[model samples]
Target: MTTSKAFIQPLDRVAIALMLLISLLIGLIIWQGDAVKPRVRTFTWENQQIGSEDVSFTLTFSRPMDTKSVEDNLKIEPPLAGKISWAGRRMVYTLLTPAPYGTNYKVQLQGAKDKFASQESSNRLVQPFTGAFRTRDRAIIYIGVNPEEKGRLILYNLTQEQKKVLTPKDLVVMDFEPFPNGEKILFSARTTNDQDLLSAQLYTVTTGIASQADQEPESPGRVDLVLDNKTYQNLKFDLSPDGETIVIQRGNKSNPGDFGLWVMPTSTESGEKPTAKPLKSQPGGDFMITPDSKAVAVAQGAGAAILPIEGDATKPLDFLPQFGLVQAFSKDGSQAAMVKFNTDYTRDLFLVTNQGTQKPLLKTTGSILNCQFDPSSPTLYCLLTQLVSKEQYIEQPYVVAIDLKTAQQKPLLVLPIAQRNVHMNLSPDGLGLLFDQVVAQEVNAPLSGNTLKTDDGEAIATSDLWLMPLLPIADTTTADIKPEKLPLNGFDPYWLP
Candidate 1:
């Protein structure tokens, strides 16, 4: 009995020792794995709001990396349109062009080693890292509805089929411009107070939620104040394509004649910067922002002047005195559209080059209401109106597309005279034109916060927005085209860049 007990006790002790030794070995392995591996300090928004224009990306690591190990091991799934650079423990990838929207991207690093680890095992990977990010869906924003949704900005994601109301309660938003980066919106808003329309002030709202190392998880859409010109009245404002600058039109509190274009940064990043400073431009007139944001075409006096946003604003470009309004500028900033008004109220549309040379494109007894340039082609979409009935002075308005190179003009849509508060827009892809036709039986009173002409200078009966395909026309004539109806009621519809 004594011999049996001793043998059993020793065997049990041996088994316990083996178990303890196995546990100790496992702990050592885990500790070594953590100690030798490098870490990444991810930028919360690194891949969240990637747009086609986001050319640069930055990645930071906890330790200095072996340049060759990372450069050779890093792989972007499906490939991307960009180049890469290294900086100590950081990596930067600059895109040659914008990444296509609505895509999922995966980044994998199979054989990456830190500098210290390279000394021990030159080809060994410290750890395998994998991350996935997605490009934003195609989205559109428009002001819609009344009573409950009045004066609010609505964001509709086309890919996700989602809708989000961006603005908070009760501030009547008049006019808003989205930044090129799609990260913010520069808007003019006025209180419920029935002040003069000129009293509208510019404010910036954060439409994006950037990832931060220190911030709590929060939803985007934060409204922030930009500039409130208490003395001068602010009007039309345009945000530059790069999202760096803003050009605004302001009028004096008492003298409407004392009006000019102003320039300021479109950022509230440091809080409301400065009330925009007046540019060297002529008195108030209809104007358009050049793509470069360096110049603007102001329809002043009897001519259209291409005035620099900075520098000698007084010394305007000596354009043809007969050209009255500058309509549209090409996306590449190479060409422009200018109008020449005749003594008999006849309107002539001319295509102007960047070198200030002008060529007449269309001549008609009609007025050019609005125009937009096609981003991908040499086409100009212009709204034309002519007095058809001399007795009633009834005018008919139509949308026409003109091929600048061919000097061919094709009528796209014949709008009804009852269509009021109409504006034309070309989709970003250049595949479609989006516009809205509003008609009212009774006189349509202009919405207080509305900036663009809300009241139909004449009367329009039923208001609905539409989308028309821009391509697939075998006939250069208007009959070959058919517009699809979009089930929405909005005046100004703009596609995101």
Candidate 2:
């Protein structure tokens, strides 16, 4: 009986301790009483790299709150053009246009207040919260003029407003495309030895370097020969947006049988060797690598072929066998500008989509130089030459913008008939067009049998660069939307990727 009483006495003390614990918990609960301000769980995208597709930012908070206070207090230093919205505790800021690459941006929240209120005051986030981020490297690279600078790849930084030559001075860059990351430039260059233009090989030069210390060592990555084949000449090549594949149009110097589309892995198991296999198709003509990079729209004879780079390479989707050229594809690969050649060799331009038939835009008796689909809209910009006289083959060239919705074409600029190498380049924002024109005296340039030539013999001329706004704005009227000549004397101007 004595032992039983002893055990019961300890049990009673244990019960008393349990009761005290519960009372303390209740007191703490009463003290809290649901009085809390929205707390920042995290301010993300801190000093990280973003791309064009990454046009949105997310901010998470500890609790849901009023969207108005946050929107009013939010300020992006340097001011990014964007829109703001709210979702529960997340503050989403979406950019109307992608932030230009190679820049630092800061976002700040001042005097942010939550929806909840206490008896005495409104619950507010007291501290000024800030987040910092960076965009991918960006630049417009072009070939330079002057014999010394000619063929040199020029990297003009859009963000830094600086320029750097990326290629060796001895190499003359014919054409180039930048990888999506803006890190390296893949170019076709030939040795300045008066060598056959077909001797040009594919090479990559570093146009970008990691500005952040945490990134891969600030390496001006090596300029490596990506593909070198003495047997075949690499002409035009495109790197897939996903950076997994490189589709090159190569012409065998000796055998016409070797002329076709070649698919190669952009990366290798061993950096020492590059492996490229030919796609099972007819000889290549003009083609655009799809944004998805899995397939390419190739110009096969008078038709367009969509051939796959992987899986069953044997099968291809053929479209419009009468169309001689596939000028361009839309950003989403949903639409294309196709050109058909008549028996007279005159070209007719048509707009076709992935799910639709060819909608005729314009037909020209001269030639269709090049055409590109605007990234943000259904408009297609084209450079076409109109035959002024078929007898002498005299031509007048113009830059025209065609609206796919209305099927109306507007001539934006009319260039001199002699501007033979005219190329139209749209700005990254899709608001401006850059092109080149030649101003020269018509000397006794005897008519060249192949190309457009003057009745006189001397074909001496000077090339001038020009820029024109492609958009409607408050500052410029449509009548006043003339091409402004740039001081830069260059051609084949391409917007950096």
Best by TM-score: 2
Residues 180-207 of candidate 2: C-alpha lDDT, one tens digit per residue:
6667778887776634556778888886
The per-model lDDT (C-alpha) reads 0.70, 0.72
Alpha-carbon RMSD, each predicted model: 10.3, 5.4
Which 10-residue window of candidate 2 scores lowest in summed lDDT? Answer: 448-457
Question: Model 1 lDDT vs. the true structure?
Answer: 0.70
Model 1 CA deviation exceeding 4 Å by range: 1-136, 209-218, 268-272, 355-357, 444-462, 472-481
lDDT of each residue in 215-295, candidate 1, tens digit only = 343465788777787778887887777777788888788887787888886556767555578896568488777788777
Could you tell me every candidate's TM-score relative to the true structure? 0.69, 0.81
- Which pairs in model 1 have colliding backbones? 52-98, 280-313, 418-460, 439-460, 439-461, 440-460, 440-461
